[model samples]
Target chain A: MSLAPWRSRLTLALERNPQLNARYLQLATVGADNRPANRTVVFRGFYVDTDKLKFVVDARSQKITQIEQHPWAETCWYFPESREQFRISGCLTLVIANYPDLALQQARQDTWQELSDAARLQYTWPDPGQPKADAAAFESLPPNPKEPLPHFCLLLLQPVQVDHLELRGEPQNRWIYCRNDVNDWSTQAINP
Target chain B: MSLAPWRSRLTLALERNPQLNARYLQLATVGADNRPANRTVVFRGFYVDTDKLKFVVDARSQKITQIEQHPWAETCWYFPESREQFRISGCLTLVIANYPDLALQQARQDTWQELSDAARLQYTWPDPGQPKADAAAFESLPPNPKEPLPHFCLLLLQPVQVDHLELRGEPQNRWIYCRNDVNDWSTQAINP
Candidate 1:
């Protein structure tokens, strides 16, 4: 399938501002209480072919549970220096240690291995959001490849809609792209 | 009522990192479709006495409608320089031109006046989230004080729970504060 025209534009924008694109993005997911919950997650990369935004998270994180209950999620990413914001809403799919798909499991392992040892240490810690006795306790547990942290998970957000807003220009510039059933995108310029 | 100990700590943190605290924060609200939607909003300030977070938006914004339908919302704020993150979840209350409370209406008027004329231009534009014919059209229409933009609104988030995470530490530091019925806060250290 041909790439969506807006996808190329988004890719070029990211290329021009690599620092902003790679920085932390705020991910919003519907909580069990039906309220919207949000937290910062590092933006890994975007897959043009599949139209998926990649990010890594601990398998046992509360966000994973939230996404499991409601696959729909939205992310707000702002490039401070560029004065641009991208609001992306989509459905999520998780790749975990026991993911049924072999290819996805292998991909998760590769991503896990690429993380720095210090970063990987987080996944080995006790369950997140749970009360901890002491911060010092985590120091005892280091990243151990032999014990493979089953909690390491890869998250993929397949975007159905993307709203881009450039706040630098006069009157600002805003556009929204909605993906169709066949994966083609229809774009509309909206007032900022 | 006396301020909660945790609230004081939060206040101190914001004071120490004023730039990061005052910058744009990501606000998450559940949309009409029951999907979590997110966008960046300017951080106005925190009301120490009332324990509320304040921000202003056009009354006709989709988020205003979203909050009206479901008062519960979440805000994710990250301070890159400080390597800190704050996840605040709460119920929202709106202060509009015709709000019943006299004090709130006065507060909204004060905030509207404080905004720069260029910033106030947004309220004068056509309803946001709707398609527009031309971006240049907004340039022709300036903020007219006599024709008060009735759509200008102030939003207050009374946080029920606040999660503070400091990623600068070795094991990282995480704490959550939940406000009880009497407005007192209970704090717990959680695994990061």
Candidate 2:
């Protein structure tokens, strides 16, 4: 059979993952000491039509620098007690800053509203090296139809390979699917 | 304030997360190439009494090897809609075969039985590199009235630091709680 069947399964699997929305993804990158450094990021959205995942990153975040130097990245998503998981590896690209997509930025702000009082404090103060924005920063921009942040850019990831892992028994089984150059996927049961 | 207050809060959080019984944890390790490699492992149980997180791993797994070489590791858990997350980093140790009570082993086995058919398939055909049951390997051996799988070991991680990330609207906040050598915890808010 043509690999179409497996491609369909892969697409469906991505859709089945409820955690894919605003999921917490940990990106591992090489640090100054050559040790692995990982931090959590919010998943903005996935383009099932294009088989691509989208996120936002500060142009100056340490991770952005690491990804630029080494494009290979691994992302992990976990939901407690849920039998769904995604361990994906792919190359990431910076969507041009001028991409007129305020919709994504609005959705991100909406999701941010759902956090607790304690959680809200985390973002009010940017981490060292993270792009800084102040109250005046938002005031200076014209409110005609968009919010302006010079450092804002959409980050798109085209997954090269994804391993869909389900909670089997003690020895977890993994279906490793790889996307061909043409964006089609092939699945194989690898040694879990 | 007494530390008991915070510990009690943690207890409530754990209760709210009962479904956490089955969680996917990403273990980041230094690969031979000096880059980071991550793998997902199911959390077996938590020793609340000892304040340790427990999980099973194949003695031959790459992560096990990595831990042997470098004990520093990070574990992360998140809920997408809740926008709440738990991140843990600390030293990890592998429990020897002669550990845990017989009752506990039986309880774990019972939980294993509750998994669905697809889940059962993962362990039935054991992966050589993962932890699994080998009935034939144990057939000739006398059933140890004490412990099952005398070769299997549970890995325990004593969290040195734990961070909570909350992504509510307007402001995002992160709180870090660190354990002193004396077992006392100090918590403070950090920039997100």
Candidate 3:
């Protein structure tokens, strides 16, 4: 896929913000009760050769259920050094076991192989969002790097709209990019 | 309104992160189309002696319409210095002209007065989220501090639940604080 217009801008922002936290972003989803739920999630990089952004989430996490129910979500990412913000709204695709896409399954396995042993160990510890357990309960052996556990799922967001804001300008600058049904992206500069 | 269980932690976080961006947060709301909409907004301090967090919004902005349709929203704040994150979920209250509460009207005016002249002039600019206009259209004069424009609104969030996560700990830390109908808050540590 050719690089999206907004994607290039985001790449520049990421390049300018060299801090590690630049990969951290806030993801929002509609909960089962219809209340808005949000949390910080790390960007696992773009899905291999695709425009879809990749993130890792435990299938046992609360957000898994939220995504199953509503499917729609948004991510807000801010680059402090660049003083820019990107709000991308899209549908979340959770790649769980038996996800049906063989390529994505291979991608998930590759993503698991890329994680550090410490991160992979946490997935074997306990169910997330559950009541805190004793410290001894977290001493599980590290999982194999080649094979991710059943619950270690890849969360992909295929963006449909992007609202980017640059806060360092005199009056500031804002742009909205919308992808139509035919997958054509149209952008407009708007009042900030 | 007494201090919520999660409020004290957030207070400490703010004190630790002395940077200007500490007050900026990502707010997420369900849009008119049922898709999640997220944006970065400055935290304009709390309402007069109440737990309701106050924020200013351009009534002409798209979020105003989104919030009008779906009042629920969540604010995700990350403190880099403390390595902590707070996801506060709640219902939104918009105080516009002809609002019933006299006290809130006073609070809204007080909030308007706190903005810088440059910020105040933005309320006089053309509609937000609209197509690009000529550069001269944004040269509107600043409004009176004592009397805010009709579209200058106070957006308040009365939190119902807070998910606080600290990424500094060995296994990390997470707590969920929920407020019941009677306004009492209960907190529980969760697996992170």
Candidate 4:
């Protein structure tokens, strides 16, 4: 990866302790009706070589369907202590646990296994966004099977644009980094 | 306004102290390319009569342009302390300071005047999202004029759908309230 100065700065920001503003990332995706939807998704990791942000999701989630219909999405991350905001726009790709690519499939399995049993139970629930019969029914549902759920998938977001806003300055500082067709990044300082 | 049980619950949540979770609200709007964009916007107020969520914004902001292109938007707000999330989808309407309606215009003036001088100075800055020269140039710029900047706008989001999720439940509880053709809200329990 030919890291530009801004890219290096972003890398360092992400490398900071996850406890310090790296874990919770807000994801935005276009719904079926062409409206925008926003939700909080835990940040799994970032791949510097591919310039992709990774997260885990249940395959049956509404966001997964929205992403399939419209791959274009954005993520907004705010670090309250630093008073900095990062807005990232990109295309999303879903890698199923049983993908054809051996390396990717192994990576998905490793991620799934790394999750706590309680977290993995989320995928075992009924269809999301569907009407439920009763609150008690949730407890009576069958237990999760021994193997990993088939509905677990890894989502990778490859960013096309990254806008960083730092509110510490007198008038605030906004910077935009855009990736060119040749995979090189160009940076500019924009008005806040 | 015929308040449903869920609607009452939402109103109570918002009425809580601003220090709790009523101050910051996440806004989602579609970009020019039909991609979703998410950011945090302060919650100025909620209009029960009109069923609108009100906030302030700079008229020159990219979100204003995006709203003009596609008014459909959604806002997701989470209260970590309460473990509650409110997902609201709606159409946006911008009420300029010099609006035709006398009451609204007066309200706009009052809101603008109530803002601290430092807060109102944001509207006097150069166009947002545009490239800037240097950090020092911001300090050298002229002071904000006595009059309210024309770029200051009151944004009202009229909700068509409201989803409330409470994570305190064993399996979590999700309820969706959708507005029908006649402007009446119908509530349903959705699987979490």
Model 4 Cα lDDT, one tens digit per residue, B28-77:
89988888988878877665366787888898888888988998888887
What TM-score does each prediction get for chain A alone?
0.89, 0.64, 0.98, 0.85
Where does candidate 4 clash, by residue pair? none
TM-score of each: 0.93, 0.65, 0.97, 0.89
lDDT of 1 by residue, A1-192 (tens): 676556776676677677643468899999888999999998776643566888898878888878889999999988776678899999999887889988778777777777777878777677888997565567656676544488888899988899999888677888899998977789888877
Task: Rank the candidate models, highest DockQ first.
Answer: 3, 1, 4, 2
Angstrom error of the Cα, residue B101, model 2: value is 16
After the best TM-score superposition of candidate 2, give how far the Cα of residue A72 lies from its true spot, in angstroms.
3.2
Distance (Å) between predicted and true CA of B95, model 1?
Answer: 1.5
Whole-model lDDT, candidate 3?
0.89
Segments of candidate 4 deviating more than 4 angstroms: A2-22, A135-137, A140-147, B2-7, B11-22, B134-137, B140-147
Worst lDDT run of 10 residues, candidate 1 chain B, spans B139-148
What is candidate 3's lDDT per residue for B55-137, written digit by digit as tens? 99988888988999899999999998899998888899999977899998888888898998988988887888787677888
Please write out the lDDT profile of model 3 over residues A50-156, one tens digit for every residue: 77999999888888999999999999999999999999989999999767999989889999999989878889877877999888888888888899999999999
| DockQ scores of all models, one per candidate | 0.74, 0.20, 0.78, 0.68
Error of 2 at B11 (Å): 2.6
Highest DockQ against the true fold, candidate: 3
TM-score of chain B of 2: 0.67
Runs of candidate 3 exceeding 4 Å displacement: none
